[model samples]
Target: MADWDDGYWWSADGLRLHYRDYPGEGLPILCIPGLTRNARDFADVADRLKGRHRLILIELRGRGESAYAKDPMSYVPLTYLQDVQLLIDELKLDRFIMFGTSLGGMITALLATSNAGRLAGALINDVGPVIDPAGMARIRSYVGKSISYPTWLHAARGIAETQTSNFPDFGLHDWLAMAKRLCRLTPAGRIVYDYDMAIAEPFRVPGGGEPGVDMWPVLNALKDIPTLLVRGGLSDLLKPDTAKRMLETLPQMEEVVIGRVGHTPTLSEPPCIAGIDRLLARIAAAG
Candidate 1:
């Protein structure tokens, strides 16, 4: 197992946020997970890269050990960007590689536009400037629901049942592993989603789903930065055309698509691992 310390920092609003800091030499890799996900989502990556390069796996507010926001409206991407910025300042990180997935990828895009100089490299996993409506509807359908299962097995089975199409190759063991990452064992002995349910309130409002703004300009800001784009072959979120446009916008960007998965890749897939290694090497050589 990779050695890591539980790190904490306060948000501007005084909420205590958490992260997993795996210490090492050289430039650190700052990981930002998907919405409703937490630091554990990057455990595999941490284990692989531990002692080679530092890894900071962030738990965005309301997820993992982070303090939940009293105001649900604060769950927006810009708010998330602010929270991440505070952490960067707290760590005094002058430059770092960003590995962002899903909602985190959106935040990374915003960062690229706002402060491109701070990024050493970027790995955008399974997301693009334009989100597909089908994926948005699918995510909205289950994001806020309060559901629990009696045991880990039951929780894994529940996820397996509902997400069979998304992860066609997932076996019972795979589902159980995913469940361990996405759900928590409560004091009452039930297993439940790890995030604050209130995080979904913004989605309920009209025109509140994925941001309506054009994000191409935000993504284009990465043109001069070293970047790697990872996609899942069955992904509904990042369609083929959108991925093509992203490459067009940043023609030098490297890409890899994991087969038989949708919406996101766990970053542990062999192809993704290789692509990330290549990206990291390029960043190092540039320095």
Candidate 2:
């Protein structure tokens, strides 16, 4: 097993972005976390892919150990694209693959449109050009909310229960790992996750009032780039219909659906991982 190495890269605005690298000699794969998530979210998948690819998991600004932006509005997608660019430059990677979940998927879409030359391929997990408003509202409810738990185990239990529908087969260890990633022990021994609550302000303020921006043009812009879209079978966020639309528009793209999951399917699951492996194989064959 490869040991995870931790580090940080300073963004152009001076916010320190945290990341973890699992070293390998093959292609570099950059994994971007969802909104309010961090590098640790990819721990399981990264561990599995360690021998085949150099896994780089980034803790987007305002999440994980990354420094929060003073201007909360900067938390938008454009800022995140710049952050990815800086991280690539700092690591001296000329080209790379992106594996993004949810909000991270949006970032990947933006980059695919804006910097296609720097990208080799992209894996978008449970996100598309059109976002579900109900899903957005559900996410807003928890993004910056504070939760108090008496113990790490208690927090883990809470997470497991709330996420039971999505991960019915996950064991205690999975919960424990999730709790550790989502929360940190304070000097007083209190556990808290690393994130600025204000990071949720913009979305909450926007409320589901608008469809936000139309991303079809952005999606169409990346038609030539090799792409894969993974959707959780039970996901309310990325509807199956939209996935079909994506496949129709991007004829060369690959798509997969993980059974019994919702919102997003962590690529760690066997089915999802197999799909990703196939995508990588195609990329290798092309090269």
lDDT per residue (tens digit) for residues 1-287 in model 1: 64999999999999999999999886899999999899989999998998889999999999999999999999888899899988988898888889999999988887767666788889999999888989989889999899999999999999998789889999999999999999999999999999999999999888675655688878888898789999999998999999998998996698899999887899999999999899989998888
Error of 1 at 100 (Å): 0.4
Residue-pair clashes per candidate: 0, 0
Predicted structure 2, TM vs. truth: 0.92
In TM-score terms, candidate 1 sits at: 0.97
Error of 1 at 205 (Å): 1.1
Q: 188-217, model 2: which lDDT tens digit per residue?
A: 877776677777767756433222568888
Residue 165 displacement (Å), model 1: 0.8
* Model 2: CA > 4 A from native: 169-171, 207-212
Name the weakest run of 10 consecutive residues (lDDT summed) in model 1: 205-214
TM-score to true structure, per model: 0.97, 0.92
